[model samples]
Target chain A: MGFFDKLKEKLTKTKQTIIEKIEAIVPVGKKIDETTIEEIEEILISSDVGIKATEQITELLKKRVKEGALKDYNDLKLLLRDELYKILEDNTSLNLSNKPSVILVVGVNGVGKTTTIGKLGHKFVSKGKSVVFAASDTFRAAAIEQLEIWANRVGADLIKHKSGADPAAVAFDALEHAKSKNKDIVIVDTAGRLHTKFPLMEELKKISRVMKKSIPESPHETLLILDATTGQNAIRQAALFNEALGLTGIVVTKLDGTAKGGVIFAVKKEIGIPIKLIGIGEGVDDLKEFNPKEFVDALFD
Target chain B: MFEALSDKLEAIFKKLKGKGILKEEDVDVALKEIRIALLEADVNFKVVKSFIDRVRQKSIGKEILESLSPAQQVIKIVYDELCELLGGSSAKIQLSPNPPTVIMMVGLHGSGKTTTSAKLARIFKKEGRRPMLVAADLQRPAAIEQLITLGKQIDVPVFHSFDLKDPRKLCQEALKKAKIDRMDPVIVDTAGRMHVDEELMQELQYVKEILNPNEVLFVADAMTGQDAVNIAKSFNDKIGIDGIILTKMDGDARGGAALSIKEVTGKPIKLIGVGEKLDALEEFYPDRIAKRILGMGDVLSLIEQAQKAFDQKEAEKLKEKIEKEDFTFDDLKEQIRKMRKMGPLENILSMLPGANKLLKDIKIDEKEFVKVEAIINSMTLEERKNPKIINASRRIRIAKGSGTTVTDVNRLIKQFNEMKKMMKKFKHGKGFKLPKIFPF
Candidate 1:
């Protein structure tokens, strides 16, 4: 562990120590006081639970306090765990929709849309399904070429166009080919245009429309890919895209590189979107389907 | 009252003013906040972790200035470190001591290489150089057209072979055209793949060998975040890079790639695209960015951007209003709108030289400003000009009118009063003299 990592590890350890300290205090069967509440709030915030979510959790705890549930520290701990688990558990499982599942990966530029698609393709292809990639981000330099490279690496067929071609047209062609080829699944990669950029975002909407033109309920899942290093902003981006595109799931990339992995919990709580996959490394095999239990366990451990 | 973050940072640094004894714990606490804020802003965690550690080592037990608080000392350390992380100092594209310096643009698709190239060409033109663009990205249908369009818009010459099958040959021919046309600085725009494919790498290598360009810049979009960092590393490792051009600096990106790329790949960021406009290209200056990260405020970037976006005549008119102390709600609203165009509230504030430390803890919500704006817009001109006219009844009416509660209306009025009072103080004094990390 280098300087920053050691410091972070120490900081996190301090946080854990604080949590353990708090955990011990709760078990002492003392009434929860203002100091205790403040400590809990600090703990939550330090854990990157986010100010909003921490406030909500505090409010919920306050309500229990108001109800004359004069609980001691153990009861408080149980209450805290139960409330956190409730908020975090609902979106735990990755939902891979019915056969020939269409996972439409979306994000702003550089969130690893192409890489995520490649990893997802490898995951699906390895599971005995014929996967095809549609390179729909034709606006950026070499976007199509990048997708083709991923497609080749994963041993999946790719539908590509010349750079600056219509992304929606490419999606149209991919869906048509997928249907005809009887492909098990199709993963369409779209450009990460700013959600505020109406024209570029409108182009994405057009791609969704074109895909539906081929398979009425085609894009079975819209996974918003976020860079895990972005922390809360990743949550904001997910919210914006969800508002714009009604995302079905999320894929948080660069987990191995960032200490802001606390964002995974925050995103799950805030957006209520299942983290379908995570990109831990750059290799095709680096992506793993999000297992919430494993994630939480790794975090606490 | 505006809580521009710049103001809050000014307050923090003010407390630290002139007392430069930085203890390890002082650095630790300050770095804790800085780390969290950067991570919150979406900066890479590893980058933040390493950054804080470096600051810790350099800052611990340091006592270099009198009358300076540990906080200010720590801020100074972090500020300098951030500048260092961003590429020690600003590095310009070597103008080819000879005319027609060759620059090759490379990066994955959607990395904004093409747009950045055009922006760079425009920058060169401003520097009084004849810039010629080569449409070497022939794989894409409109890639060439995009370059040509940008060239036309900027009035720079673009060379292309729409029917060319080989990009290598096209680059050679474009170089020849540049020499013949006496266009000393030639920028060749190449194609990008999704990932680093061998064929594309070889193609890039071939182009580099044939052109023997002075600068090979990898144009990575800041919005791509970590992926751009990875791509830059791969491209640098595979094809070798002189520098990096981070596009989409205007996007709601936490800007980790800007801090991480230089450290990871050892390539200085040559240029950055702050906006979609052809003239939005800026020379990458690491020190200014570092100060911003430490909450010292990036006044230089803010000034540069303001200068670019400011209409001098309009600015003079605003200055006159400020001089007269007649700044109205309408003007306030207009400034808010213009500031939005600059970037997020926190982002813009951090870029000001020493403003970051002042605004450390202040949270300025974009939506809250929108609410305040709505309340202001709902008022009639007379009502806007005369605050006394807003009685309790009028407050209620305005609240209902603006889809807010009377409390919200009252809050806006109260906040606006505080803001105007602060502005008056600023007008009289040195306008909140924030401590400079470096004497201007």
Candidate 2:
């Protein structure tokens, strides 16, 4: 199946919960009234679209209502989709202009950073681009071994150190290996840490800084991996990680589950960070390039 | 991030403060703001709607509207409603009357089940129970190894078999071994899966039936958004969870999922994972969490932690010394050491009411405590007891010994004298008060 179709199927549960609820709230042939708008607002908030983004969308709809541009439920639905798409629209492609583009993956623990790295490496390796995996997540037990498995599967060289070694050293070595091997991409997988931990955040900054020693202006893409099920804290994660590392993009994972990944709407609206990828399932091929059009379609259609 | 909801509420109520009485319109306005704040905290809209309705009903009552400090009344109503929705109090895990009570951990992937299982085992082991950990999560790569590693760290035995691909069989064997080893409270760490995955859910059901766990805890991320209701409901319906364990409470997330899960599943949150350490798991207290959400501060938790760190005999000894006006740098150093044992100084301060707002712009440098300890360690016993003996040259020598500046040593001596003066006043039957020690 095509990526869109797969996304639609993976998001089928989310659609059934959110889209069906929206449809039920705003039925056909019903006039869009203030009560209907309020119900739609509840649906958006319940879907985790967040208060600010939901207000932005509803405010637009209210304006349309005032202008008499919004006539029916279908129009409101389309308008909502359009607004979400606009917020989500950005440069959703990875920056690989350099010969050995470095992608630093960071997030809180248990957000599927390692698995996403594996899938991401598979994507690049399958495109005939040599890749190098940096197992810089020296904190978690067996995290390196997990990434090593992914590297072997994706046919990418992995640079790792002992479990308690410095993560910056691991990233430094990976960059050196990538340069020597002339690899197309180097993905650095850092241990998952809560953004609230100042020391850990400092460590991530150090890793980013050390990469520049090997390649000036290295770590071309700093992606924060966010769990779809995560709530408002995702915004804090994005804001802090962006402030710390100048995060280039975000990768929303576990969309195959019931979570609509609705927090991304708030993340996009608040942080203005483009989502480069969406991980739909556990398979290596489940990772897909994020397309706002297809993503909105999967939600509304 | 956890302070956001309370901060917003505090802002709203600031306008209502000092008002003589609350009108119906005032209650409506307050409820509207509360609704938005709760929604922003990621509480489910339906839950927020009902919660607001209840709060409004109470706030609109004549007794509440006519009460003195109507704003405080409204806050109390909201806190009570929140506490009601969050459950009455903290609930403990129900150990079966029969030996070998089984606990099965289930949740969506990456919810910290494996780590939590180990933490739970450590807790039980500490309580003098032979708790065995079962690595039933055969889905995720290296998950078993991860559990084994954690088990090893805690010195707890973990049950795993490579030949047993089926989790049902794996769990069955693990239970048999637990019984044989006389391990009570066997914890089975199941693979994290989507709640909608029928095959995986069915597999969990099979294992649940086989083991007949005494407590099926639904582990969830405390940062989970509005989807918490659906996920919690699905797990409760699919495998019938007995309780919940919210992880990553150390994050700034306001943890509205705790409220949502409780509302939907009618299950109590038995525990919370506060940090990454193996012993960071803590018993869930709904009232304390409610206070935290309202920014009223978690004084009870703070007191509990303080009591654990401060020995009663030592405290009495120090009190007697203070009453006799013998407060010295050595005693201050000992008190600081005891306070340090209660965890991070910032965390301890954050537990005080209105401290979040107070400390928002101020960063508490814990290094100051280290510097104080070093300075105290450098002081001679005679010099510590008699600050008058520390001449200018003695200060310089002590500063060099402690690797601090002479100015720092002078400041410490001055602060110590001022603290002694304050204790002298308290010894005269005046109210006791702690003097500000940190420069910040």
TM-score of 2: 0.93
Model 1: per-residue Cα lDDT over A154-211, one tens digit each: 8999998887788888888988888888888889988766654545666677888888
Q: Rate the local accuracy (lDDT) of all candidates.
A: 0.70, 0.88
Candidate 2 C-alpha lDDT tens digits along A21-49: 87887787677888888888888888888
- Predicted candidate 1 versus true structure: per-residue lDDT over B1-440, tens digit per residue: 11222333455556555444644555555566665555444344567678878877877753533425666555677677777778887787776777679999988765777888888888788878888999898764457777887788899988988688899899888887888889968988898653436677888898899999899998876644333455667788888999998877755555766777788888899888776567667777787665544544457777877776567998999878777877777876787677676655555665655443454445445666677788889888878877778898899889988898898888777766666676677778756642221101
Give the DockQ-based CAPRI class for model 2.
medium
Listed in order, each prediction's TM-score against the native is: 0.56, 0.93
- The 10 consecutive residues of candidate 1 chain B with the worst lDDT sum are B431-440
- B10-33: candidate 2 lDDT, tens digit per residue: 888987885778888888887888
Best by TM-score: 2
TM-score of chain A of 1: 0.81
Model 1 docking grade: incorrect
